[model samples]
Target chain A: MPHTTPQTPGLFSLSLSKTVEFALNQALRLDEAQGAAFKDFEDKTFAVTFTDLGLTLYLFFTSYGVNVQNALQGEADARIETDLPSLLGLRETGRLSRVTLHGDVPLAEALIDALTSIEIDWEEHLSHYTGDLIAFKVGHATRSAMAATQAAKRQAGETLKEYLQFELEVLPTASQLQRFGDSVQRTQAAVDAIETRVQALLDRL
Target chain B: MNQSKKTIDFGFSEVPLEEKVKRVKGVFDSVAGKYDVMNDVMSLGIHRLWKRHTIELSGVRPGQTVLDLAGGTGDLTKAFAKRVGKSGRVVLADINESMVRVGRDRLINEGIAGNVEYTITNAEALAFPDNTFDLATIAFGLRNVTNKDKALAELYRVLKPGGQLMVLEFSKVTQPLLAKAYDFYSFNILPKMGKLIADDEASYQYLAESIRMHPDQDTLKQMMLDAGFDKADYLNMNEGIVALHRGWKY
Candidate 1:
């Protein structure tokens, strides 16, 4: 049920692939940004603190299916109250770019509040992340299955008899298996047509 | 609500604010002079094979423009110049001045005088106009970038319609035995060689760590696709020790 229609193998269909690709790119970019932050505070005690915060936020978003931008903005809003001054102090000492606080008070308190609110639901969030991974795995497996099915049909000596055997023994499903059989027949017809057209062109030349 | 509290990862290490580029530049500057030699020794000449394969896959005909990002020592640029003929132009770009200088001198010495330009440019913020290049390549480079997604987007923006982008870099070794051997070689022998040859152990250590931290072949192909590339795919070489990813703008 998680799998959608099989992706057509062509330069077209960039829409679906683009979404998956963008998410992966964002994850890697966020990781790189966190690494830079840790390196900047190498000698300071807050180095690990900042690193943990970044990693925690990353894990939290991936697991919870929360939009990262909204979650980050919410955390920033909550941290402005209690810990903003100290956070600003740390940032200054670390020589980091000045972070603009959303609220009047310090930004750290707002972040602390945001983190506290989500701590209770951490497990639930993690489960959602697992679900996303499972969905991706299913999609990958389905694609592989389709490729294998096509490859099996291409082997020589596996003609109508082999096709009959596949329908009777390999696949028991009446509806899905019939659709696949029809697809294979249609593909073969299309390939034969292309070959004939190419031969005709060659003869004319 | 500090909207600017963004974090970034540099290899396996994490850092904050805008220090990522500076650190990356430092890493490259420390090894610029010895980079080419170390590359040859590290891969035992396999790097040449990878670059040659990139050249073949590039399909850059005469009178086509090419931009080689982080084109250290101008190896790819030199090859591209010849292929593009006298009319086509090749740009050799790197963030570090030391690497840029070395590359410029190498190209000049090889008598590749005309139809080539050298610029020191950051991968994150390339200064070219939109849709400028026919082909763009980042060789042994992307892992060192501060914001790889931004760089990819920039690459996409600069490429003309139907332009191609090729990335050649280290990838996850598929075979477990080969991976273990690679790990040992990288952690043990590489730094020692760097110390002896380049007199800089830390830079080589950074190199190993960065490669380990790089996304694998499939992840990177997806990245290219995400950056608006059509028909993105990668070819694994040297038992997946390295990969060549090709994509098209169209």
Candidate 2:
């Protein structure tokens, strides 16, 4: 009932909460605006209940940054209840349709907007430890790898479509699908005409 | 060495009641600088989780007062301050001035000053007014108290009606095999860690003995009930290596 999962197994939740807290605070510090996005949300608490994990993490907004913990002595100002898949969908699509938000709805929406608006200059931060040139090289390599992966994925999809449509004849080709659509439309028209004739005969009777 | 002198247990050794307090103070004073480090090294950083669990169970709310008695180094105090925010107040009180100073300085450095206060007060006789705190905690500091019953009474007295007190301390290990291994580790390896990290072997030795001398889980629950708590219960962590005793004042 309580978010005690973190305390159940060797305090794994505590470690996770600490890691998330540290990362969120670090992100806030690294933001170019210096956490100005969260200024208005100070002292407000947001809770995210991961239904799949059966854990609720409370994110307390402070003047400096956010403090994330699994337990809250009191209720959160905004609580979002969703499973992992829906959460991932929300992240990918930037949509709140999949998750349920309770309490101050406007506050939750604003918090989500603020979170999505956070833009950290990762390359700039990385350059602090690894100088400008090296950081540039690493960032360049990562971008190149991502581009290559996307290209490969597109090529694979095309190849699978060709094999399925041509080689194996397992899926209908474009022309065949068009013909099937026409036939279905024609059949629907014929059925409508037959129904109209039957209704007329019944009216005469 | 008068035969009529009141005596108390200082670790494994018996000493005069007044002397016990002084010696306990000396131990904390010696280890004050390296207390946090020694705790991490000895407990493998699991002490933080134990304290976190205690805080979770406290159900502390904003605008409610909390007293972290024997709050050496203020780990719980820092967490409570964040939750209580600007509206609530937290008092970090400890008997040993050295420990209190370390906790105060650490909390201030972490920018936790506005809603938090620090004090040097004995657990047996807290300085706060009656029914003052909504939540009170004594983590790992109760074992060192000269009179635990008196200290429990003081904690109960300070708590508001419907308030809660959480005591996080080392207790008897539940598993027999683990208990034997823990005994071996506490006696043989723990002191070595203290010696290596804190450079104080004697104080660490006393730490281990005091834990063994502290009351077991059920015993502590009964003591809280005797202290006038309406309800008292305990939860064992790490196979009973540490226990959190909670008492509610109605």
Candidate 3:
């Protein structure tokens, strides 16, 4: 568990919170769904505690968007505990399992769900700064790179498995494992027969 | 010749009480457009930190009314408006019409309208009802008021029972070396920067003088207590260059 002692946030922490608030609101604004998922969460407060940073940012939902601040007056509706990396991962993957939630579990689930539901059109946003053709090219290049990386990862895994099983002979082959399983079953049956014979002799005596 | 007429400090100079109001109004009017810019440049962008600390200490909750007295450019008001949500309200009141106009326009441009109200009113005589606001704040504007005690009293009067008042202002520096350097910068560089940027040297000079004339941390805390606050305390930031005085009405 992270230490819960509240220290006064320095200017750097305040600046970080403001930056996060600005980025989150900007993303929500660019959302194709118009952030409709967050409409029901008005006036809800979610305290997100970063274990590594020892900081808690109170995310207060309003009609406009969420306000992130260091100090909160009262108990929040939901509290989430996680490290910095986990929070970043949660944002990228939109997975609630990345953090441990306390207090109103339902509210935490709904908040995360609503946050994940916002669909921002990245290409459209990029095109505002770059021309359509450049944006499309960048997007295409990014997608191709990601796909190539996945393919390479899959190929590397298959090669490693083949090398370990066939060339190195460190791991058993499929047929060898199958035969070993059969031998174990046969030995177990013989042991069962011997146990039955002993039981019969004991009973006669 | 007119000793019977009261005189007050307008910067380092003494002027009639009514003239001081006009002088303060003129200074704000001259710098209203470039107030935010000048603040950033003058403080090396540390004014934002000061204000951030003030907001952190506010501990404001949803559905609570706030009075941002002397809320020029509506920085504090904008933050409070978001925190208070749709049900609550924040009044951005200022003595200078020019300052209020600029603040109102800027806030409106930023889409901070529904929960915020703008008014041009003197701090010594607030236009709100007694025991009305959950929180009241006067930031960087206390020294410009003709009567500091009267303004503090008004802030205390407008706050509801259990509500708090936060005063964020420039104060006397505690360290001698830093104080000497700060004084040199204020008296020498600040006005020139104002002239270079805002085209107003005199107003910036007045700013430095007014800050010097403002009460120190302890004095301001005592003033809040004298104004009927049950408990009063202060937190100095940047080694006493700026202080945040908080008083709770019980």
Candidate 4:
């Protein structure tokens, strides 16, 4: 917490919240999905309690813009409580279960849904910090490689399973493990018999 | 506005302290209509981020009182008004009538009336009572004040115990090469752009000079301490192009 209020013993948390708010607003401005998430919920108020710090962050929507503040007193359309670690982790996992909602759970979920809609173009953003060419190349390569690897994984798994089950018949159809083993042994015996006959014929010639 | 017997620095030139406020006001009045526009051109729209950062750092809460001193065009005031909601009180005060008028009108146009109050006030002698606000901010406007020491004292007087005041203003560019390039841009290009956009070059030139005339980062932190702040600190942004100084009146 970086931007905590004057009363709070921790100033850090307030700063962190402020940064988060700025980023959220910036994303909302550029992203239609994120902006639309709050559009339907205008004039709604929600409270988020950082249970560990004993601070309740209240978010209220106004005609102008969304407001994020500490909810000292009063009721809201929704109130959510979660620890700091869980709150941060929710971004990565995209899990609403990490937070507990009191008033309007569905609205809270919708808010999260809006946040999930924000698409981060890390390569484009990083280009400004790093270099344009490097960022583009890296981003492109990463997406291509990831797609190829995922496709290969799915196709390879399916093809190998099908080949073993249908073509080779090495895979058991049911719980008949002994029957499958016998079938494989029978095939092996037939192959051995053919090889032995060929060797005996070759010897006679 | 308070004036001392000693002379004050007015853009590389020392002048009578009494004359600084009127001159500063003249500059702001001349460019009141174009101030926001010039800010966008001069900083390349980075001023918004700087201001947003200041507001974020101020840590203003709902139902808390905030004094947006020198809130020209109500950039900080609009955000504060929204954050404070109906319960909170935000006073968008500026000494310059032109800037204050612009701020009031802008806030009104934005439909932000309930929580915000507009006032024309000199920072050296704030009109409000003691312990009036939980947070006070002077962004890019403190440099224009005639008596900064007196203004800081007045801010301290108005703030509640544990209340914080944030001063976001242009400061020294520490890097020499960057400073030289910045100087070239300010002296050569900024005024020309101002003349083209606002039809006012002197005010833009004054703005550039004022940035240089304002105290450096460490000096401002010391001034905040001397003004009876229990804790004072500053974080430089854009490589010391602007600094956000924060002081707690505990």
**TM-scores of all candidate predictions against the true structure:** 0.56, 0.75, 0.76, 0.64
Q: Best by TM-score, which number?
A: 3
Over B1-250, each residue of candidate 2 has an lDDT whose tens digit, in order, gives 7744989899999998889889999999999999999999899998988887777666555567999999999999998898777878999999899999999999999888899999999999999999999899999999999899999999999998878899999999999999999999999999998899888999999999999999999999999999999998888999999999989898
lDDT of 3 at A56: 80
TM-score of chain B of each: 0.96, 0.98, 0.98, 0.95
Runs in model 4 deviating more than 4 A are: A1-65, A68-205, B1-6
Question: Residue-wise lDDT of candidate 1 within B121-217, one digit each (tens)?
Answer: 9988999999999999999999988778889999999999878888999999999999999999999999899999999988888889889989899
Sort by DockQ, best first: what order? 3, 2, 4, 1
Give a tens-digit lDDT track for model 2, residues A20-88. Answer: 577667878778888777888877878888665566777877653577776665477898887645543
lDDT for each residue of candidate 4 in B171-208, tens digit (9 for 90 to 100): 99888898999999989999899899999888788788
TM-score of 4: 0.64
Model 2 ranges with Cα > 4 A deviation: A1-10, A89-91, A119-205, B1-4
lDDT of each: 0.66, 0.82, 0.84, 0.77
- Extract clashing residue pairs from model 2: none
Question: Which residue pairs does candidate 4 place in steric collision?
Answer: A1-A12, A1-A13, A2-A12, A2-A13, A2-A15, A2-A16, A3-A14, A3-A15, A4-A14
Task: Indicate the residue-level lDDT of B93 in model 3.
Answer: 95
Interface C-alpha RMSD per candidate, 1 decimal: 22.4, 4.0, 5.6, 6.7
